[model samples]
Target chain A: MTAKPKLAVWKFSSCDGCQLSLLDCEDELLAVAGAVEIAYFLEASRAVTSGPYDLSLVEGSITTPHDAERIRKVRRQSRTLITIGACATAGGIQALKNFANVQSFIRSVYPHPEFIDTLATSTAIKDHVPVDFELRGCPISKHQLLELVSAVLNLRKPVIPTASQCLECKRAGTVCVMVASGTPCLGPVTQAGCGNLCPAHDRGCYGCFGPAEAPNTASLAQHLAVLGQSRRDIELAFRSFNANAEAFRREGNAHERE
Target chain B: MASKTPAPADRAGVIARAALDELVALLAGRGYRVIGPQLRDGAIVYDDLARADQLPAGWIDQQEGGSYRLVRGPDAALFGHVVGPHSWKRFLYPPAQKLWQAERSAGGFTVTTAAEPEPPLAFLGVRACELHAIAIQDRVFGVESGDFTDSGYAARRQAALLVAVNCGRAAGTCFCVSMQTGPKVTEDLAYDLVLTELLDDRRHDFLVTAGTARGAELLAGLPQRPASAADLVEAEAASARAAVQSRAMVPGVADLLRQNLEHRHWDAVAERCLGCANCTMVCPTCFCSTVEDVTDLSGDHAERWRKWDSCYTLEFSYIHGGGVRRETAARYRQWITHKLSSWHDQFGSSGCTGCGRCITWCPVGIDITAEARAIRDAEGS
Candidate 1:
């Protein structure tokens, strides 16, 4: 019998919700453990193993110089590197710093600003090294994580849709909260993966999954304007989860305050 | 299971305004979960109907791009407005469904296919456009195709009892007249039962017509009177007004869209498109899906599931290396071309039923009819 493939999990700058999602896979964690040897996961296991790992699941955005160097080393050791959640795929919510002065932020937050070692911009893993796959979500769905691992082991292509969240809402039979109630929703331009949780609760989408394939953010922004949403509101909507993502970044930039 | 009873001759008649409660009771008595349009969360949506009082009796909805509002009508007329955001597809083709499950034992893996649950459903207030949408899906999922049959969809569709409502008024976004699917219920596309709501100064009643044997049997149980020529004329007028009220028309749009694949309008539309897939989701006939595998942490149990997907996403066309439709313009082109043009090649008809849900529900208010017209008119110029 062949030895199991080694799996490694890494973190950078994030809330750790995406990694937590993996641990939250209450039923499927054991099956995943059986399929692959957990070589290095600081969040889950204390027993660590050094790489050349077969697969590395990277979470969080690269915010500091040390993280940028660490990601390169991780890529060198791993045969297939997959980015999980919005942070690793797009710069995530921390990417809101991409629009502001990092130095000023550090000074305001910490008493010793000189001690803070950081980069001006938070960026995705793909910005530094090549990624085999990128799973898009604020807190990545546990089911998708299982599919990714299963596909890798089976030597087949993973099937993760790049469709908008609107399809989920439609299929779930949730009424259009934006159209029906004049709520400003980002679902039209956001990717599907969160199972349409917000719309089901009668709330508009916060765009946690980031920009779907080629989002028509301009049109949605204009529609929001017609719905009585201020320019600031439209900008904030695009700047939420995947703020540094190209499509959302461009749309948010368009509505930036003078 | 409810017995399929045959009906006596002569089932066409008028149901009294007060006897609407009896219709609800009759459907419930047959063991069907009665579903109809009710005002909820500020919009008319399909939900479980316990009694006739649950219907949107004195309400009418105004629909347009980026707008929907419920207003009190002149009288308590059920089924006064056209279609809403929710459709019968929700019941027939659910968003997410489990296909099978597997358990890893010491010996090996044990796989078990999910059993199909057949729950009897009676759909009230189904519009002609919605009926056409259901028929379109039937062609895709039904056994007659012999290609790939969705057993879940087939079972749910077969178990459903359709009660159609002839549109008395059309929303501003409606264009079923051009699609030739609605504004009027035709005999060939037979529903189990059809109700044409008639509200006038003199009386409020429904001119009911049974299109199938099942409908005739159901109608035989309710109180009614023979439809007079005046009543038939009144019903015809209502449908005519709806047809005339339709502003957006796409008479030969399929050929126009097919020929203009490289039109610059795609780029212009793409610029405004969020690639959010609101159009595809709201569209009653758009039926793309993706499959997912989920396993429990124990390494012992796993399940395969299918959920709704859209072409607007890059991953829908993704292979091993990358996606075929990487750009937003390409995705938008694929969606519109598939719905209007290529759907005819795959299925024998256009995928769109002209319910205008896509137009009304779109966050961007991208009018499909306007986009089609722009492409056609540009070629003319």
Candidate 2:
């Protein structure tokens, strides 16, 4: 009597981390299958169910002309579109390629540059098509993924946290690695969901959860400088996986180049 | 379900040793496993408790900023140490958890969720601060927005029997009193039973109170004496002493940090920070992480996993073509503000617990308390 909800998983240019998160739900994988119909997921299954899907999870950045055109098709096929991970929500690590010349990159990587079919810049899913919900994380947290699925099934807004990672650290009773060890951490400004993993292993945060609501990144950067990190060091830190993100890129560019 | 509080007088002057044996038997009888601190690998760590003899007695530990050492106590007393590096988190979150598994099948492909194990447990000697930490986690993983959702965690939490122990001696890194969470268990309803250790020159007894029917049942099976008014006075005095001895100070800190969100102090601290994610690792509450996938040698099957990640990592903040907090300065600024100021707005509480672990464990020794103090002084100028 009840129709099974149709689900689709889409990918662009990425490391496949976010889509992998869905499959990573090893314990809940079968339950998820029973809850919904898998309309499309190139990574998980060979069978493809044509859309007007109930739910669509989009991953990776739009890095080529074909990718830009493909996202529009994905947008048309899905009723509710959710972008997963840094590549889909933001442009992702590959967005760092946007800083340099794409033509040169293609030429260097490939002997024949003319064979390359790529765009000038790497961009997020929102840059190409409308996104209903944007889940923040390099590889989105599986717990959050489960919540999104549940919220979607219930037809309610997901109650994902908008606060910073610092709250999570405090809740976990971890000593501030930054304050205690002068190990520069990004938890104060980064969003929560990673389950305080880095701090648990006696390491500082590296901003994998992206920016929290209304982050004060400028102030934290100044504090790190006072603790004795160099400007080049600071710049390098920000320019890592998320270097292509607008906020981090802007700040990193302002720093003195070593 | 919460339990009813039993009469305090009915559960007084109970020797701690006898109570331990009784608790172990009660847990074993109830079809629950018991785990507590034990001496292993030259350190006190969490392990299974087979009987009362497995407990660490007459062993006290000396702890200071950035250091911990086990030392012999004047008397052979179990449960003398404040806490170890490992908490209850290891059992719940686990260092590694397989999210799902994928196998190539005749019908194209199949993905299966990992089998979940619901293990019932009884934690012995849970301190007030640790209890607070668990409560905080309850708010996180128990909700829809939280990064982790484990029915197993919920089931274990629901079935576990909490026996809260009030801290009588302060570890050098402890500042729970400053955080206003310990020395005396204010949220007595959170636990099924509470024990206030009564130590005098001639006697060592614990004042026990049953919080639920389960606690009452456990108490009825034990031998106890009526608590005197003097015993209550002594307990209050012990708590007061801890509050005074607290070393952390961040007066009006959350509000102050919120008011000066654009201050230049954070930039200074950024220079020394490595963004290595050590702080988040050591922090009891930092929960940000990443997901990973690995394939079998034949490449026919693949499995996915969630690994811990940090905001300090450059790729974590990427958006569009770049990161929002580009400099370590901005990254550090974002981190401190969220902890001391923004966290209050979101969680209705300051993120920092005044635990000096961050200061002591930091490889470079960046003090959070001092950071707030500097901010306060800067605002004044």
Candidate 3:
């Protein structure tokens, strides 16, 4: 019998919610362990195995110079590197720093700004090194994480969708909160994955999954303007979890203090 | 299958507003799970209905671009206003469905296909445009029309019994007349029973007409009176008024959209488009899906699930390296063109049923008819 595949989980600058999603897969954790060697997951296991790992699931954004160097090493050691969550794929909510002065932000947030070793911008793993796949979400969906892992282990392409959240709302038969209640929903331009959460709760989407395949953010922004959303509101909407993402970044820049 | 043919007007009758409850009972008495529109969460949504009291009684919806509200109607009429955001596609297509499951055993992985028996559904208060949407979906998923038919959708659709409601009033967003799909339920549309709610100061009744033999049988069970000439005239007038009120139109939209792929208006519209895909979600005919294989952490058990997907997302057209429609403009153009132009080539009809849910539901109030007209005007100029 062949040896099991070695799996490694890595983190950078994030809330650790994406990695926590893996641990939160309480029912699947044991079975996943049985299938692969949990070589290096500091969050889940104390047991650390040196890499040249079969598969590395990288989470979080590269926010510091050390993280930038560490990711390169991780990429070198891993046969297949998959980025998990918005942080790894498109820079997480911390990417809001991309718009502002990092030095000022550090000084504002921490007492000892000089001690902080950091990069100017929080960026995705793909920004520094190549990624085999990028699973998009704020706190990535546990089901999608499972699917990505299963696909890698089975030697198949993961069938994660690149569609908008609007489809999810429709499929779930949730009434259009935007249309029916005049609520400003971002589902039309946001990617599908969070299972239409905000809309089901009678609120607009916060765009946790980032920009969909071909988001018409400009049209949506204009529509938002018509809906009595201020320019600041539109800018803020585009500057959420996936703010550093190209589409959202461009849209946000368009709405900037020009 | 013999019941597929149109029944004569002899099957048509009138039912008092009070006796409408009996119709709900008769459908429930059968194995069918009756579904109807009910006021919930500040909007009218389709839900399980065992009694007539659950219907959107004395309620009418005011719908426009970026606006919707539940308002009081003239009387306690059950089916008031036009279509809501909820459509029949939800029940037929479903949000998420299991395709198959696999479990590791001593021999190997054992695969079991999903075979959960779905209860027969009786869809009450279905609109004419909604019926057209269902028919469009039928063609898309039916074995004869498409290369591959979705067994789940096909099964659900086959077991569905449609109870259509003829539109008496058109919402500001509705343009079903332009699409020739609504404001009136024609006999050829395949609705089992069609009800035209006739409400005046003096009377509140339904002019019920059976379109098929099964409908005729159901009508026979309910207490009814022969439809008078006045009732027929009143029913005709209601649909005519709805048609007149719906001023929004996109005449020759298919040809216009097909010819103007490079129009600058696409860029203008793209600027405003958030690409959130609200229009596609609210749209009844937009039937795209994606599948995922989920396993237990133990890795012994796995299930393949399919969920609704939209074209608006960046990854929908992702190839080996990157997505084809990378620009928001390209994506927006793709959606509208596919809905209006390409749909005729693929499905032999426009994808849009002129049910302005996309307009009203859009957070930014982007009207498709207006876009089509703009494209046409640009091309002409």
Interface Cα root-mean-square deviation for all models: 3.1, 11.4, 2.9
Ranking by lDDT: 3, 1, 2
Q: What is the DockQ of each candidate?
A: 0.46, 0.03, 0.48
RMSD of each: 3.7, 11.1, 3.3
Per-candidate TM-scores read 0.88, 0.57, 0.89
Tens-digit lDDT string for candidate 1 (A1-258): 898999999998988998998889888778788878999999999999898999999999999999999999999999999999999999988899999998889999999988999999999999999999999888898878877787787676675666678877877778888888888888888887788989999999998888875677888888889889899988998998898999999999999998
Model 1 root-mean-square deviation: 3.7
lDDT of 1 by residue, B14-103 (tens): 988877789889889989889999988778988899998899988888988767888888778888867888877777777677889998
Best by TM-score: 3
Please say which candidate is ahead in DockQ: 1 or 2. Answer: 1
What docking tier does model 3 reach?
A: acceptable
lDDT of 3 at A180: 69
Q: Supply the TM-score for candidate 2.
A: 0.57
Full-model lDDT for every candidate: 0.84, 0.71, 0.85
